[model samples]
Target: MTIQILSLRKKDLDKIIEIENESFVNSWTINDYINEMTHNPFAYYLKLIDKDSQEIMGFVGFYIMFEHAEISKIAIAKKYRGYKLSKLLLTDVIKRISLANCENITLEVRVSNIVAINLYQKLGFEIINTRKKYYPDGEDAYLMNKNLREED
Candidate 1:
């Protein structure tokens, strides 16, 4: 199973939205993706593409403004779960932002997502704050950060 992580293109929107809707209860629509891809200069999007099937298995999105990079969303296909694909997607995103000279990367995860929390922590992100009821379903979120500029 070869998965290629590539910079996302407009043609991938339908596939990206497919995975997004499958993973999240509230997913971004195709139009939303189009608007972001076309209009947002700071936005970075990447996809995990299955080489054989030519399918998009997952995607990660973030926005870099000034010295900060905020991970907007990430999700893998339902059939692709338990394969550690999301971690690969996010890790690549972080690497790309760091190579582009971004100083900070941040994301907000649902407080109940212990798996994601552990993954982020293992990748060197630290919790900086929390937002009460940040999700539409009243789920709380932990605001996390990984500083690219300072190793220690």
Candidate 2:
């Protein structure tokens, strides 16, 4: 199955929300996505779709300001996990950000999400710091950063 990465559209939100709700304990609402897509100048969202089936496999959201980018969220459909699709999606995001002249990228991941932390680390993101009680449920988060210029 060929997967195509494309910009997130209003029509894609239902599937995106389905994946998001299943993937996270606290998921963003439709309104939250709408605001990001419509009102946030710095925000960029992308969705991966099966070219043959047209199924939404996963989605990622991020914001770019000046030379910095921060990943806000990323999720794969329940059936799509363990396929390294997240890595593929994020690698694409990094490439796009680099092409846009971003100097660095950062993201906050729950400390308990070892799988995601591993993936980020493999992608060259280093743990720069920790955020205490960063989540609504008071979970701590690890702040990871990757310097795009260093990869060059």
Q: TM-scores for all candidates?
A: 0.92, 0.98
lDDT of each: 0.88, 0.94
Candidate 1 similarity to native, TM-score? 0.92
Clashes of each: 0, 0
Q: What tens-digit string does per-residue lDDT give for candidate 2 at 36-117?
A: 8999999999999999999999999999998999999998898999999999999999999999999999999999999999
Query: Where does candidate 2 stray beyond 4 Å?
Result: none
CA-RMSD of model 2 = 0.7
Q: Candidate 1 on 35-141: residue-level lDDT in tens?
A: 99899999978888989998988888899998889999888889988788888888888888898788999999999989889889989999999999999999999
**CA RMSD of each candidate after superposition:** 1.5, 0.7
The local lDDT score (0 to 100) that residue 88 gets in candidate 2 is 98
State the displacement of the C-alpha of residue 99, model 2, in Å, after optimal TM-score superposition. Answer: 0.7
